[model samples]
Target: MATAIGMVELTSIARGIETCDYMVKAAQVDLLRSSTVCPGKYMIIVGGETGDVRAAMAEGIKRGGELVVDTLMLPNVHEQLIPAISMTNQVDVRGAVGVLEFYSIASAIIAADVAAKAANITLIEVRTGYAIGGKGFVTLTGDVGAVRAAVEAARKDAELLVETTVIPRPDKKLFDALL
Candidate 1:
């Protein structure tokens, strides 16, 4: 069930994976066949010996972090991200920590959106408000765990581009106010 065959020759097989209907047919033969979902974007398939695959996976995760920052502008903005939890019967979380950049609402919103999806949450809404330092904040909401994970993923994704901090849900009053 391995996705990749060991020591594949760099010929038609690699090229076929890049552009060929047979790639899909081959997948039908085995769903585990190593394939890149979004080549050159968030995903890439680099094949070699078993050891190479291991290193590639690690590098992929690392590169993903780099992509997150490139896509989300972190510098020149006061950014603070946290999970927003709901106290309703669903007990669901529906937003992410506000991502601020250059005090530009649009950029902050984009960061929040990218962070939200990376964390696997539905972006319910994006709201802007004042931070403690008079800096602007863009708050996003979605599933609780997704929001938490997204924040983490966003940080990892932007590891090279920016530094980030995680803020857990605050007091009941504040949570209620945001909801």
Candidate 2:
């Protein structure tokens, strides 16, 4: 089966949870994540076959109504994306490091994908709307040139880029703290 990922971000936690329940019951999608984010927003992420994920997303959007903040359906997501977002991917932070912060989780995910495909960089982490007041951020590491290219690519079309920085040669302690 061709795997796909879908996400629904809602303004209200109660409505988001209710939509998530309807979404899952509407299709054979697997619920990957369902939780409240900072500032009292909620999100639901699901994964399954392409069609199933689409069906689930459709149900979520229909049920979300006025509470719908944002929605996404990636038919062909990067294989490493989930692990990176889940903070389970181990990446060696060598040479240089880049960070991209965004105002929305969907924008951050898009930036991460663009950055990963634009340069030979390893994703250190992809955090979304958990403890950062509903914002999102992604970290990457590679050679100086590669890191710069990745960060530049991510910044080009970000929804709201809070900040972006590329450290040419970060100290080990910084990597330890971040990674």
Candidate 3:
């Protein structure tokens, strides 16, 4: 299992692909994502051992250079984070719900990890890329206090225009739409 995750956002799609190649070749890291984002941006995500992830990120950054726009490296990631990012996490849809939105995918991912580690919450979803126009958001569910705390912690860790809301007990339709 990968114990660490790293992502690098780039302005040039061609350069992003090149960086992705260099990153994976530099270390034994899994390429989790390498695709274009909204507004003509590109992103690369990698996961592996902490040291391997660091080495891959270093190579990506070196190759990306000025094309690199944003980056994040979580050496000790929460267990639920990867599944949530992969859009495979099971959402029980119980308890209060919290939503955290950010201007960039990197920020959204970072916040999601922090939120999961902060409280006893289940990550419902982490939406990013084209459907959202490059902006990203995370949804989680837990008890009222846990949801609130998770939202706040995530909001603080994110950058750019961050917005957060906690629904005491969301309507079924609301959650249905969320899913």
Candidate 4:
């Protein structure tokens, strides 16, 4: 079965929590993370089989009402995405580096997945709306060509892309902070 990931971002923390509760009860999805983010937004991330994830997201969106800020359902998420989002992946930064910034946590996550799958790159980190005042960023490293390709792919159709940059030879100290 193809694993999937679903996310719901809401303006109200209480409503987001309630929606998450209802969503979990409506499907066989596992709640990955549910908490308030910077600037007082709420986000819920869930994972499971594609059908289950879709069902859960449908319930969340229905209950979210006007509180919904964004919703995402990736039926075949990149294998590196979940680990990177959870900050559990250890990446050896090499070659060029790419960075993508977004206004929302959900958008950054989606862009990271797209970039990781677009080229041969290592996801350095996926920082969501924690201390960045509801903004998020993703970092990746690979050869210059690969990194550029990945960044380009991430930029396509991404309305939330605040900034995108590719550093051919990033400072070693930079990796110390990011990875």
Candidate 5:
């Protein structure tokens, strides 16, 4: 149910937490996540109406100041994006599977949104830098052609890309570890 979402990555954990508090107080928004990632990076994600998210983002960036590393705001976010990030989207591992990995969380989230909008696909997961050494990755499944197209579209927008691949037919056992 997220219409607009904003994210801020900071170099300081304390600044990031303080920014999150002020951001929520600045606007009516949902605090999707606010925690330290790998390598001592801190992240904050908020979602709500466009205006509200915008205000919250402004406050967060201002508070983050020199500690800010990266930020992104999606005004018309894809419907599948939130579910994927929350690990709530359900779908079988059908057809081809595409994967996108990035060095930044914002790039991975952006790739997920772009992929969802570019083709008919089911998002498997939109994983952020939690315990993965400050890396982000996205997974989706669809027909081979659609998966390929979606991956290409997402790649063009991805920043700090680490790797990308598409499997025409992934062994089902591989999904066990991914899930």
Candidate 6:
């Protein structure tokens, strides 16, 4: 089976979430919205089927323009799928799913809690850290897909609220060790 992946770089984190909600409802597709906001930029990823995927990307552009986005980024649309467990499957997954780095502990906790709720995980352990300066990191665990979603949600939640960086775990060692 082929799945369409649509990635839209938006002007603001809030607008990105709004655009995603609009696209999801308009296309009537079961989709997930994840965002990462760096300094002066926001990148949002919305994935689903090809046809609707394209349309959703278009909607994002439209919304961004209407919102007077200072920088309207070109939407990147693609199609890809992997043989992974669905969110419905109750599998005890263990690994470093995703980590959202924040500038403050308050922001980190806020993002972590939001991600946990979105992912439907009860026991979410949020680790706070200051690598060198006063940067904080929030790590969420649980089902693979859920953890990914949670991380994205956390990023979106923290974008404007604080200065942060969201990092998804491509390697599972660190997360596995913690477990």
Indicate which candidate wins on TM-score.
Answer: 5
Q: Which candidate is the best by lDDT?
A: 5
Name the 10 consecutive residues with the lowest summed lDDT in model 2.
Answer: 77-86
The lDDT per prediction is 0.34, 0.88, 0.88, 0.88, 0.91, 0.48
Q: What TM-score fits each model? A: 0.32, 0.90, 0.90, 0.90, 0.92, 0.38
Per-residue alpha-carbon lDDT of candidate 1 for residues 37-69, written as tens digits (9 for 90 to 100): 222211122322334344444433343433321
lDDT of 1 at 52: 39
Superposition error at 156 for model 4 (Å): 2.7
Q: Write the per-residue lDDT of candidate 5 for residues 1-179, one digit (tens) a residue.
A: 34998999999998889999999999999888888999998999988888999999999999999999999999899988888888888886477889999988999999999999999998999888999999999999999999999999999867899999999988889766566
| Model 4 lDDT on a 0 to 1 scale | 0.88
| Model 3 regions lying over 4 Å from their true place | none
What is the per-residue lDDT of model 4 for residues 1-179, given as tens digits with 9 covering 90 to 100?
Answer: 78899999999999999999999998998888888888888989898999999999999999999999888888888888887777777776577889999987778988999998899998888887887898889989899999999999999978677999999999889877777
Pairs of residues at least 3 apart in sequence or in different chains that clash in candidate 5: none
Q: Which 10-residue span in candidate 3 carries the lowest summed lDDT?
A: 154-163
Count steric clashes of candidate 5. 0
How many residue pairs clash in all the candidates, one count each?
A: 14, 0, 0, 0, 0, 0
Q: Candidate 6 has which clashing residue pairs, if any? A: none
